[model samples]
Target: MSAELYDFQDKIAKIPEQEKKAFVLYDVLGYKYKEIAKIMDIKVNSVGVYIHRARTIFFEENDDSSCRSRRPMMSMVWRLVA
Candidate 1:
């Protein structure tokens, strides 16, 4: 499980609007790409790309933190991108 920090909400609120919405829909809401796509009325490929971009930005911003402080769940995205 990930650390539940009160500051995480503030961190998320700081993210750009579109990416923040996508990140919350997919990660926090546990929505699948297809489900997100349908709910957002976007293409599935767009959903995937949005999530990929969001993950990249999130990881880059979190790099100064320790490994445990970064998103452990992001390893799945790295594997997919790799």
Candidate 2:
């Protein structure tokens, strides 16, 4: 049997502005970290921070357990682009 995936765009909506953008652009749109940095006009390193924060927030919202205790396998969750 294959595993199922779920869309978490609703969860992403709760994240801070820059982080939401970074997560959507990088994870959903398949953009590179460097590309997201260029588009956001921020440091390349900051792109990683944004993505990391976004993922953390997303997991925190999705899971009832501690976020640190269970890091979601993000690749298993898809974000719907509308």
Best by TM-score: 2
Q: Write the per-residue lDDT of candidate 1 for residues 1-82, one digit (tens) a residue.
A: 3333434544566677666667768865568888988888888888767766666666565664353222555554444345
* Per-model C-alpha RMSD: 7.9, 6.1
Whole-model Cα lDDT of every candidate shown, in order = 0.63, 0.69
Query: Please, what is the TM-score per model?
Result: 0.58, 0.65
> In candidate 2, what are the lDDT values of residues 8-70, reduced to their tens digit?
545656899999898878766778989999999999999999888987887774555443321
Error of 1 at 22 (Å): 1.7
Model 1 lDDT at residue 50: 74
Worst 10 residues of 2 by lDDT: 73-82
Best by lDDT: 2
TM for candidate 2 is: 0.65
| Shift in Å, residue 47, candidate 2 | 0.2
